[model samples]
Target: LTPELKCDRPDLRGNLVIKEKAITYQAGKEAVTQLQFERAVSCFSKAITLQPDQLQTQFYVERAEVYLQLCDFNSAALDYKHACYLEPQTKTHFHRLAFIYYLQGQCLCDQGMFLDALESFAKATELKPNFKPYHMRLACLTALGRYSDCIRLVTNWLKIDPPSADLFTLRARLYHQINQAALCYYDLKAALRLNPSCADALSLLEEMKEAAECSRQQAVSKAVEGELTNALSKITTAVEKNPEKAQYYLFGIIYRRLKDFIAAIEDLVLAVELCDAVAECSEREKPDNSNSLEEDAQAQLVLTYNDFAVHCFSQGFYSEAIKLLTKAIHEQRDESGLFINRGCFLKQEEWLFALADYQQAEELDPQNRSIWFRLALIHNTMGLHSFGKNFQDAADKFSLAIKYKPGVAQYYGNRAKAHTRMHRMEEAKLDALSALILGSTNDELLRLFPGCSLSDVISSATAQTVKAQLMEQTQMWKLAGRPVTEAVRKVLHQRQSLYRTGPRLSPLRLADASEAALCAAKHPYAWRNFRGLGLNC
Candidate 1:
C-alpha cells in the first residue's frame, strides 16, 4: 500500500478493528496494573499501529517503561523523547526526560567520562531544577578541581535555597575551597543549626575551627615555631597564665610533630583528661543536652582521638593505635580503611591475627592490591604456599604489579620463586633477571634466597647467554648426541617418544644394566657412571 493510502486507511478488520484495538490498549493498561509488562508493551504497540494517532504518546511511554525494565536505556530514551514531543504539556514527560538524562549521566560517570556526565547532569538540572543532580554535578566539578565553576554553581544553588542545610554545608565546602577557614566555620555552624545530626557538617565545622585557631596561634607565638623544648616552654608559660584552657592538645600536637614521643603522649593524655573534666562539669550544669552543641563536641573528640591513633601508628606505637582504632571501628563498622590500617600495624608487629582483618578489608574492597599482596605475602611467610598461589594464578595481576612497581625487586624475586616452584623455569629465570637488573644493589637477590646464591644461578650474562650456558651444560653429559647412562638414556628415549608420538612407554629394554653395573666393579667390562654425573655422594 502507498504511504498516504495507508495513513488514510479505515477498512481494516479482525484484530485491526479500531474499537476492539482501543479496548485492547485499555486491557494493556490493566495488564500493567497486573505487572505484565511484556504483554502490555505488545498490546500497546498493536493498539498504536491499529488506531494510528489515538494513544501514540501513552502507548510509547508504556512501551518505553517496558524497554527500561529490559535494560534498554537507549531505546527507552528514544521512546520517552518521542512521547515528550508528542505531548509537550505532560509534566511526567519532562520528568522522564530528566530521569533519562540522569541515568545517562550515571552511566557515563561509571565509564569515567566525567565531563560528559557533567554535561548530561547540567541538562537534567535545567529540565527539573532539582537539588540532587545539581549537587552531584557540583561535587564532580569539585573532584575534577574545577573550583571556580563549582563555586559559582554552588553559590547560585545556595541563593535559591538559602536556609537549606545541604546548601549551607556545600557553601562551607566552597569556603574551604578558597581556604577561607573562618568563613567555612561560620557556614558549617549554620549548617549544623539546620541539621544537627549531619556528621559531615559537624566534621567540617570542627576542622575549620581548628584551622582558624591554628592560624591565629601561629601568628601570635613565633616561639611556637621552634624545637620541642621551646614550644613546651611557651605552652607552659601560656598555661601558667590560663591553665584551665583547652589549648594543651595544640601543644601536644607540636610535641608529637617534633618526635618527642614520651612528652607528646603525656601532654595528649593530660589534654584528654582536661577535656573530660570540662565535659563532665558542663553536663552537670546542663542536665539536658543541647543536640547541636553536643554533636560539635563529639566531632572534636572523634577528630582528636583519630589523630592520636594515626600519630601513634606513625611512631611505631601499634598497640596504642590498635586500642584507639578498635574503639573507632566499634563506632563505625563500615569503614574498611580502618581495618586496612589496623592490618598494617598488626603486620608490623608480625601478628598473624592481622590476617583476619586483611580478609575483612578485602571483602569490603576487593580492588586494593596492597591488601591482596599482603595477604599473599603472609600466606607465603607462614609456609602456606598453596594459599599464596593467587599471585601466580592469573598473568594479569602478576603483569600489572610488575608494570607499576618495577622497583620492588623483592617482589619480582619472590614471583620468580613462585614460578620456579610451579616448574615454570623460563618464566622464573626472566623474573630473576628483571629483579637483578632493576634492583639498585645486587644484594637484594642474594638476600632473597639465602639458600642458593642468585649470582651462581643467574650468570653475569643476558637471557640468550644463559640459554647458551644451559645448552653447554646439557652437552657435557651427551654420549653420541644422547645421555650416557643406560637408565638416563632410557628415560630420555621415553620422554622423546612421548613428545614426538603419543603416550607410549618402554622404548628400550633395560634387562642387564643393573647387573652389568654390579659386575663392572669386578669385571672391568660393564658400563659405569658418566664422567660429569658425579656418582659418589
Candidate 2:
C-alpha cells in the first residue's frame, strides 16, 4: 500500500527466514536418512528448538529411530515414549514404542539378563500385541525352565493368533518337555504345514513320529539317568504317598546301577506284579481313565522286569535268572538280548539246557560277539580243543568284541587265554603282555611263568648255544618239511662250540633271527613258530 519501496525490496527478511527454516529441516532429514545417527540426533534437536510445534511427533520418532540404530535402546525408548505421549491414539506411535521395548529386551537377553528381558517383552506385548515377540519370550521362559510361565504365555499367544506357526512350534516344544509326545506331535504337524522350512519343528516332528518305537528303549536309558535325579524325586514322592504301590521298580534301577543284582530282581519282580494289578484295575474299574501317565507306568514296569532279568543273567544267577527270563520270553519272545543272556547263564550252570537256548539266541542274533564268545567258551570248556576249528572260531568272536570295545583289557586277556589253550605260547604271551600294557594286572598269570635270572641265563649260555644249534636244525626241518640234514648238523656242532667262547654268533652270523642269535643256541626251530608267527621271534 504505502510501503511500495518496502515491497520492492523483495521481502528479503521473509525469504531469508523461509530459506533458513528449509535448510534446517533438510539437514535434519538428511542426517536421519543417511544414518549419521549422532549427527541426526543433534540436527533434530536443533530443528526442534527452531520450530518446537512443527512436526514434533515426527522429529521425536526420527530421533528415536536414530537412537535405536546407535544401540542406545534406553534413550530410544524414552524418545518413543515421548512420541507416544505426543500422539496418544496413534497406532504407529504405540507400535514404535513397543518395537523399541522389544529391541531393548533382546539386548537384555543377549546379556543373559533373562528376567529383565522377560519383563521388557511382556511390556511390549501389552503395548502392542504381536505373535513373534510373545513366542520369543516363551522360548526365553522355557530356557529358564519356567515351564508353567511358558505354558501361560504361549497359551495367551495362541489364543490371539490361533494359526500362528511360531506359537504352535513353541507350544509343541513345551509339551515335549512335559513328556506330552502326542500333543506335541499334533502341534508340530500344524507348524510344519504352516512353515515347512522350520528346522526345529521338522526335527521335532521326526522325533515324535518315531516316538512309539523309541519310547520303550529311551525310557530304559532315561530311567537309568533319571534314577539319580528328578526321576528319583518323583519315585520318592510316590513311595511316600503310596508305599503299597510297588513303585520300588524305580529303586531296582538304582540298585542295578549299584551292582546289587539280587536286590534289583526282588524289587523289579514285585514292581511288575503291582503293575499287572494296576493294569487289571484300570481295565475293570477305571475304564474312563486312559491317560498317558497310566500307560508310562505300565511300560516302566515291563522295562524294569526286562532289565532285572538281563542283569540277573549277567551276574551268574542262573536258576533265578532263567525263571525271570523265561517269564519275559513268554510275555515278549522276540528280544535277542534276553535269549542271549539266559542262554549264557544256563550254559554256565547247565550246558545241555544252555546249548538249545544259545542255538536259538544265535539264530536270532548271529553277529553278537558275546553270544559267540559264550558258545566258543562252552565248546572249549567241554573238551573240544580242536585248535584248527575252535581257535579260529573263538579268534573271530574275540576280534569282533575287541573291535567293539577296544579299551576293555578283559577281552584281550580272554583271547590270550584261548591262544594259550591252543599251545600258541608266543602268541599267548604277546596277548597277555598287551593286556598288561592295557592295564590288566593279573598276579596269578604273572606267577605262572617264572622269569629267567640274568646270571643263570648267562651262566648257561654254552648249553644255550647247543640248544640253539638243535633249534636251527629243527627249523630247517620244519621249513623244508623234513628232518635235519648232515651239513646242518655239522654247522650246529660248530655253532655250539663257538657259543661257549663269548657271544660268538658274530654280526654277520646274527642274520635276520636277531633274538635267537643273541640269546643262546636253542633249537632254531624252538623259536621257529614264535618268529614266523610275528611274535617276539
Candidate 3:
C-alpha cells in the first residue's frame, strides 16, 4: 500500500461517508434495543446529520423515537417535524408531527396561553384537517371571542358531502353568539337532517324554532287564538324533546293558564334549575354578558314563582302558594313585594311566619303602607296569643301603619286591642274613640276584650252614675252627722281619673253609617264575639 492513501478519490470518500452513516444508524438501533436512550439519541442525531437530505427522513424519525424514550418531548417534536419536511410523501411522518403539534396546543391551552395554543392547533389542522384539531381551535377561538373566524372555518368544512352534523352544530353555536337566530335555525335544521340523533342540534332547535324563543312564541300564539289544547300539546312535546330552560318555562306557563297548578309548579322548578346552570356556564363561556344573563334569569324565576303562587292562592292551596312565594323571595331577596305576598299567604297558616315576612318587607321599604298594615295584623294576632312585650310590639306596629296613613280606622282599632292587652287603659280609651270616629263600630271596639270580664273595672261605670251614687251616700252621711273619711276622698279621686279618659264618640256626632256606635253607651260593659269579618278594622 502507498503511504499517500489515494485521498483524492472522491467516489471512495463518498462511499466511506455512506458506510459511516449506515454504521451510525445501526449503532443507534442497537442502543435503542439495549434501552440506552441517551446513547441512542446521540447516535441517531449524528446519523441524521451525516445522511443526505433525501435519505435523512429515517434517521430523523429514529432520533425522534429515542428522544421520546428520554422523555424529551420538545426535542422529539422538532425531530418529527424535520422528518415530515424531509419526506413530504410519507403520511406517517406528517401524522406524527401533527399529533405532536396537537399535544403542544393542549399544553399551551391548559397553561392559559390561548393565542399560542391557537397557532399550534391551526398548524395541526393544516396538516391533518380532522375533527379534534378543529374542535380545539374552535374552542380556543370562542374563548378569544373570535366567533367570525370560527364561523368561516366551520362553514368551509361543512361543504363536504353528507356534511358533518357536528360541524353544522358548531357553526350554529357561533351564529348564536353573533345573534343570528335565522342562520342558527337553518344550520340546526341542516344538522338534524344529516344526523337526526344529534343532541346539540336538537337542543338548539328548541332554542331557535321561531327565531324568537320558539316554543314560547308558538304556545302563546296558540293560547291567544283560543287553542288552549293545542298550545299545551305543543309545549309538552317541546319539553319532552329538549327539556331546556325556555321549553320548561313555556310549558309551566301554559299549565298555569289551564289552572293545573301542580304541574305548573313542577315544570317551573325545573326551568329555574336549568336557568341556574346556564347562568353558571355563562360565567365561563360568556363572561362579558354573564352578569346580565344571571340577573335576567333571576328575574324570570321570581316572576314565574309569583305567577304560580297567585294561581295556587286562587285554588285555595294556601300552603303551596306560601311555598312558591318563599322560593321567589329566596331568588330575589331584595324584592319587597315578594315578601308582602308571601306574608299574605302565610297569614292563614301561622301569624309568626307572616310576621317575619312582613318585617322583612318593612325593612326593604320603610314607607310601604301596605307592609306596615300587614305587619300590624300579624303582630295583633301574636299579641292575642302572647302578652307583655308582644302586646307592646303589636301597638308599635299599629302606630307605624297609622303613621303612614293616619285615617285608617282599622289601625286605631287594632292599637286599642294591643293597648288593652298591655293594661294601658287611658291610651286604649283614646284609640277606641278615634276608631269610632273613623268608622269602626262600638261592637268592633267591644270585641277588643273577647272573653274578658270587666265587672269591677272602673271604666264600666259612667261619671254621672258615680256622682249620683256619691250624692246619695253623702246625704246618708249627713244624716249620720260624721266627717267624710280619707277612703271616700280616695274613691272620689279615682272616679275623677276614670272620667278624665274623655267623652266617648257620641251617637249625635257619628255619621249615619256609624249607627252601631250607640251600642257601647247602652251596655257599657258588654263583650262581643271577635270572630267576625269586621274585627280587623
Candidate topping lDDT: 3
| Angstrom error at residue 6, model 2 | 18
lDDT by residue (tens digit), candidate 2, 333-378: 5455556656645444565576566667667655554555555455
Pairs in steric clash, model 1: none
RMSD of each: 37.3, 26.9, 21.7
The window of 10 residues in a row where model 3 has the poorest summed lDDT is 528-537
Global lDDT of each model? 0.61, 0.61, 0.68
Regions of candidate 2 where Cα sits further than 4 Å from its true position:
1-22, 33-35, 160-172, 175-537
TM-score of each: 0.34, 0.34, 0.39
Count of residue pairs whose backbone atoms collide, per candidate: 0, 12, 0
Error of 3 at 35 (Å): 65
> After superposition, which runs of candidate 1 have C-alpha atoms over 4 Å from their true positions?
1-47, 130-135, 189-202, 212-537
Deviation from native of the Cα of residue 218 in model 3, angstroms: 4.3
- Give one digit per residue, the lDDT tens place, for model 1 in 1-537: 798778666664544586787798898889788988788778877877875664588778887887777666777878888888888888898898788778877777788888988887888898889646544677568767887788688677767765778878877787777765555667777888889988999877666555445543643474445555665665654443234445445465555555554555565555556556666775556334333333333333333445566667667677887786676566445445556666655436454667677677667656555555555554444432332645455333444344333345555666676676677877776767766655435554454445656555465556446456434533442322232565677767667443557555555555688876775534332222111211110
Worst 10 residues of 2 by lDDT: 528-537
Error of 1 at 343 (Å): 76
TM-score, structure 1 vs. true: 0.34
